[model samples]
Target chain A: MDEDAKAVATALARESAADGLRRLTDLLLRVADDDPGLAAIAQELDRITEELDQITEELDQITEELDRITEELGASDDGRRPVGVDPVAGRANACAPPLEVWCLPDGTAGASGSLGITYQGPRGLVHGGVSALILDHVLNVALSEQGPAAAGGELSVRYHRPLPLYRNFLATGRLSRGADGELRAVGEITVAGVVAVSAARIVGGRGVRM
Target chain B: MDEDAKAVATALARESAADGLRRLTDLLLRVADDDPGLAAIAQELDRITEELDQITEELDQITEELDRITEELGASDDGRRPVGVDPVAGRANACAPPLEVWCLPDGTAGASGSLGITYQGPRGLVHGGVSALILDHVLNVALSEQGPAAAGGELSVRYHRPLPLYRNFLATGRLSRGADGELRAVGEITVAGVVAVSAARIVGGRGVRM
Candidate 1:
């Protein structure tokens, strides 16, 4: 097919998918009505939900696999040093790792990273809570590096802007002493170098082995 | 088997599992080192990770099945009942309806009642981010109740305590007036009459419906 034809086909597919999604949302909003008709609608939407979930899983697998390949290529280009990521220790910490843990020098006290995911709402982007999770991880790392009393006691995340889900994200965290003998930590997730989520935490209490 | 024998067997199984888990954690922590024997260990951990993923999927399925059964029971208890629930419609809207939308009467809100999940943590149980989510949903319902505003603005969620994940929960949300041209909304999630999560937000901007 010609390039124009291909573009038309892609546009049509996108339009159809958007319409289907809109219909599904409408059905869910109507679910509270308890109409007998919903039994059929529910079954139909359940199938759609399962399919969408499957697609999401496939996409995640693809993304992660691609990331692995990219990391391998990047490593090879950089003289084949193994990526220095530390496997996540436990759930007491955030669900993922910091970007600097494997890439930076041991004394590298401060570095920033970001998370880009589909489920975020602002900027039609990653949710603020998700951003907070990233901040927690980043700040936790900062605390861990700064010595004892840096784990995490209280975290305050302020949403400065809606983080768009598009790629090229960044998060940076830093640790400093607060007035009450606690470590004050601040972090931010940025998109295209713009601050989206800003967070502060007074990190104190028992330190866990990260 | 005798009661004592059964108890002994259970204890033995628990001890073995704990030992195995500790061994696995130890192996995972040491995976990155360049040991000749690390390949076998990596294979074993890969198998374990796959098994854990399967277990998580099975548990999620079982939970969904249980929710379905409970929902079916709620429906059969009354023939005239509507289905599902809408927290804003008030009690005047319900008739023990199956899947009925009932406006949760204000002041009775709690964690389990609305979130459909156990409130997990303050950073307050339910995680500050989850609180924001629940509160955002509650506020969304309130927006539906209140006529559209000219411009809505910030959402602030205050964590009073760690929201405990409990069997049953409730939450109440109110949309009220604030100082100058801003709408004030408050939400609280509770468990067995104890407050778990509370949130407040200002709504603004034309949300692009995607």
Candidate 2:
């Protein structure tokens, strides 16, 4: 498939807009630059923001309705209904670098995405928290369906080396049952085939590692 | 100060554009809506992408120069130079919720921000990894000057309860010296006066918690 089509298939929804959001993020990082092209973007954004402000003000009339609809969607009796936007791998979430996830034959979950300056942490590296975000999402995805409710557990992250920006990275995960009978999802972020950050999401009760 | 000026001052730089980027995010979440107003944003983004495509193509000319400048900025004898964008709290970083951080008289580091659907995690709540992101950034910020190099060690996060969206939350951190002489930054996320997540950043060598 074409790249556009692929992005469309990849994102859960609003792929064009989300891609645009990503580009906007990239451009904003250069805003401090003295470039005239960058200034044009600043002006364009002013117009867009003005337009959005007006629409949103009118949108306030339907605010209650939207909230009601959102509530109905989130109205799970079990209190675990997903809020639809996954901050790391969920395509629809603009906050996400939105990794593309797939599976290996052994059921290991795999995700791939290129880190940019937007995910920048200290200086040229991806944020430690961003790595945690990716691993947490990918491991949970790799876990069998048995562990959805176990998603909100403690995450232990060991930063072996700083993950860098503007590099394509792969994150892979597999589920293992701990000795204490709790399920654990373990994963790593690899740049150019080397592990940079390794993590494990311990589901439920702070159980021991597998 | 007025709200706009306050946002400007609170942000280290590029406050207007970052805030605009954020509003764009809020608008994108509602792209699923059939509202005529929402359609305008989609159309506007299409125009934006076209314009950006042109500018970025020109930007490719300076790509090397930008990279050179970025390299100069990132160039440090030691490998720990910060990349200048903080994903959770850095005002200049569009990816950040861009929390406002300040120091308490007692040397506690404090951060305040309201998360939105963009940072949404599992259904109807903040992403688990996001809490880790906030705590990680805040803790690193909180630790006294002794621990900058120790920032990337390890982060342990325990989710006491789900941190909700569209609500204001505060994360606070303080430095604690471990018995082994390693430093640890301890902090928590509190919403409406309730602790939803607690975290500790173990600075180096896998030191025990203080």
- Candidate that would win on DockQ: 2
TM-score of each: 0.42, 0.71
Model 1 interface DockQ = 0.04
Off by over 4 Å in 2: A1-13, A31-84, A103-106, A208-210, B1-13, B31-84, B147-149, B207-210
Q: Candidate 1 chain B: worst 10 consecutive residues by lDDT?
A: B91-100
Q: How close is candidate 1 to the true structure, as a TM-score?
A: 0.42
Instruction: lDDT for model 2, please.
Output: 0.63
Give the CAPRI class of candidate 2.
Answer: acceptable
lDDT of 1 by residue, A105-127 (tens): 44223334433221333323454
lDDT of each: 0.40, 0.63
- Backbone clash total for model 2 is 9
- In candidate 2, position B136 carries an lDDT of 80
TM-score, prediction 2: 0.71
